[model samples]
Target: MTKDFKVIDEYYEAGRKALKSYVTGFVLAIFLTLVPYFMVVNHALTAQNLVWAVVLLGVLQFLVQVVFFLHLSRNSRSHWNIIVFIFTVLIVAILVAGSLWIMYHLNYNTMSDSPFNTNEGYIPQ
Candidate 1:
C-alpha cells in the first residue's frame, strides 16, 4: 500500500505550469535547429564552419531547453538528487569519450600502409 501525500497534487500543478510556460521556448529551439540545418544544406555555411556552428548551437540550445523547461538550477534538486544527476552525467561522459577514443584509434590503426593489406598485395598473374 502506497501513501499518497497531500503535496502530490501541488507537485502535479507545478509541473503542468512549468510545461505550459516553456512551450514558446521549445518552439524557438526547434526553429533555431532547423534554421542552421537549412543554412548548411543551402551552402550558406562552409562545411568546417557549419560543423562547429552546429555543435555549439546544438549544445547551447540543449542547455537552454534544460534550464528554461526543466528548471534545473542550483536549488532545484535535493542533495541526493544532485548526487544522482552528477553520477549519471559522469557515466554518460565516460561512455561517449571511450567510444570516441576507440573509434578514432581503430580508424587510425587501419590507415597504415602494409603489404598484408589486400589492396596492396602482390599480383598472382
Candidate 2:
C-alpha cells in the first residue's frame, strides 16, 4: 500500500501570504497611527477626537497584528491556543484594573486624611 499523504507546502504558502498581509497591514496601521499626530500638530483634530482616533485605531491595529501574524485559531494545539489567549487577556485585564484601583486608593480614598491636605504648606498674607 502506498501512502497518499502530501507534504505541507500549503502551510508554507499560506504562511508567506499571511506574513505579507501582516506586513502590509502593519504599514497601513503605522500610517494611521501618524494621522492623529499630524492632526494634533495642525489643529485639525481636537484633543478628544485625537485621543479617540488613536485609541480606536490602536485597537484595530492590535487585532490586525494578532489575526494576521499570530494565526490564532480554535484548531491550534487542539484549542489550547485559545486557552492561552484567554489567559493573556485575563492578565491584561487584571493589570489594568489593578493599576487603576491602586491609583484611585492612593490618590483619593486613602489620602483623604493626610496632613499634606491644604493648610500645612502655605505662608502668611
Model 1 per-residue lDDT tens digits across residues 56-82: 888878777766665565364456776
Q: How many residue pairs clash in each candidate?
A: 0, 0
How far is 44's C-alpha from truth in model 1 (Å)?
1.8
Model 2 C-alpha lDDT per residue in residues 22-112, reported as the tens digit of each score: 7887787787678766776887777888788778877887776666567664145748777888899999989999998776655654435
TM-score of each: 0.61, 0.62
lDDT of each model, Cα atoms only? Answer: 0.73, 0.69
Off by over 4 Å in 2: 1-16, 74-78, 110-125
lDDT of 2 at 79: 80
Candidate 1 contains a number of clashing pairs equal to 0
